[model samples]
Target: MNDTREDMANRVFLISGGTSGVGKAIATGLARLGAKVVIISRSADRGQAAVKEISEATGNSRVDWFAADLSLQSSIQEVANIYKRKYDQLHVLINASGAVYFKKELTAEGIDRMFAVNVLSHYLLTNRLLDILQESGPARVITVSGHPRFLKNPVINFDDIQMEYQYSAMRAISQSLFARTLFAFELANRLEGTGVTSNAFHPGRVKSNLGRNAPWYLRVATPLVNAFFKAECGIGVYLASAQEIEYANGMFFDEKKRIIAIHTQFEDGAGNRLWTLCEKLTSD
Candidate 1:
């Protein structure tokens, strides 16, 4: 399908973390282009509010939302099942759901918080919906990844991926981002002939709630940092809607322009190992 804004009209878009920040911004922009958008959030009230606000702002009443924690495998599975039951097609999937913890935490499933939401949820949900996306054809999957600068080594540490022994908030978050990038590349490779494009992008630093759980100093400095350097939600809108990048698969982007990060391009063997590990971890 062509990338014209009018083409997006009636197209089905599903987004996670669309209640606020970059996710919400992307949802609003797509809704403005007349797409039928369904957002998933942890809070029903927040989800409803976001749907109403986006609908009112875009003058498109097709906006709706579902409630899901997204931090548990069961929740992710149930959400995907509900979506599949209602929608037969998914033209675009924007995975903007992410979180950073000030300290190491585990979900009800006993998985690391960073790994569960930022990494595992993206893997499971996208995989579950792959059939619909493939059937729809010419679909796009855009996952919001972290900046390359945050990852120094970008190793998966198969010995202790969840960092049960040497856990640190920063390290856990960084590894999750790297895993996300790795999964994006691996997904692109697997979906090569499926007419589905999978890519990852760094939205730059934005003043959002992603840091709400971080140190007080970071919370104080987030606004100042954003004032000096930050990418607005429009960057996400462009990647999700621009026709020029319809075939740009397996690439990473910063500020709407594709750039190669050396760390993310690990040996093919490493990527395959990571993919296998993810499959095992997310398996029922």
Candidate 2:
């Protein structure tokens, strides 16, 4: 399914956490297509190697990587500014990094690491790069969510987004889902008329390391789920090439490019609420 119509020739695709898993898959794929790919990762060594691997495989030397920990708000600001100064315009921003922690961890900024990495980092990165994205015009921000948006554990206890008060596996998963839906919604709302589409995807239970830190049951069962299904890391490109907000700005997806629209949580009210809360927390 080569999508040459996308015309990504001179475009730049910036993705976080591109050293491994689905991030690596998309980074490499984008590079092969002649789009200048910049992979932002945590480790300089790993980041450079990822860029090298992509360059070698694609025979496209336009790929590069830089290191930055996205969990901290300050780090995100610096990285965003760096990208703005470095690139004239960004055609695509894939905020694909995510985390699911068994126990609570805090960023240097004292925010919950799970929320900071999975939700807040993506939020701040997208907002900070909003100028570049809009300047590029017709840019796309494809965030990685999980399966069946409705089947998700969907409890949005705003009082417990961090799950610090009463932490549990279920609570963490549920809160993350709620936050993602709301993030997509609010981002799409804010990007209206800018031609910068902000959408999220359900990458399915791929053979990825998403549950590496989870309990034995989760860690053990994820492979089983992938084995019983088609686990193509390149399924990400299906998302990468899909009609950019041709239907709706903030739609969800299932495994096989199926659109999932459980709209209650992604509605305007919930989206606004989440946006306001995040604003208070970051207070930039």
Candidate 3:
């Protein structure tokens, strides 16, 4: 994926969770290619720092950023509107913002933090920006899926979405896996021919601090977990650089060109159902 960005057709990319790790890696790479890149994160200082680093390294001042507390629907709306006014022609959206904690917690809006950040926020942001992406035509929507999907059963008790009964690290990971992946499939179906496509990527486990928000037990256990994994960043480039990036919508990808099986929760009906839930939940 190095330097193949010379002939890009005026693409503008919006990326969440861009302050560090995979997001920053991908953003810098894209900006180097002359692609307009926007990095989204929770802190304006962090987002701007990333933008400055990306711009300095790539020598492309086209890199920009928007800060939002994606865990809340209102912030999602605010940032999406800011993006619209900044970039009139949108081409790709990377829904990479995510958080996890050992204990279950709720956002200020009374939504579960894990579910809100990992699932609902992306759903709302993507749907809100659907029109700009459609207008950009041949746009791409890519999000990150953790390899934990294969290691765990991604089943959520829809009757108890708040996880009121049981809450654990494993439980939150499972629910996010199911909910977000299902949303990806449904989102693809919803905008199949509008010139926008949605897909998810599993950035191979890297030495990043994904478990930063987890409890001490997880913090002590992460090193053991990471031992079984490999480097992750290539997966980002693969998702961003695939030859058929436009038509390769609604698929799951790993580091290279390999396609992973969609989680068992991904049925056509489930996709639409999740989309409907998203719309109602985020409607002003």
Highest TM-score: give the candidate number.
1
In order, what lDDT does every prediction score?
Answer: 0.83, 0.76, 0.76
lDDT of 1 by residue, 141-223 (tens): 99988776765577778779889999877678778888888888888889998999998888766657787788898888877
Write down the RMSD of candidate 3 (Cα, Å): 2.8
Q: Report the CA-based lDDT of candidate 3 relative to the real structure.
A: 0.76
TM of each candidate vs. truth: 0.92, 0.88, 0.88
Instruction: Using lDDT, give the best candidate's number.
Output: 1
2 against 3, candidate with superior lDDT: 3
Candidate 2 per-residue lDDT over residues 20-69, each given as its tens digit: 76678788777766678898988888898888888887788888776789
- lDDT per residue as tens, model 3, 125-238: 988898898888777888888664463545656777668787777877777877887777777777777778888877766555588887688789878876875534676755
Model 3 is weakest, by summed lDDT over 10 consecutive residues, at 1-10
Model 3, residue pairs in steric clash: none
Off by over 4 Å in 2: 1-6, 149-153, 215-235, 242-248, 265-268
Task: TM-score winner between 2 and 3, please give it.
Answer: 3
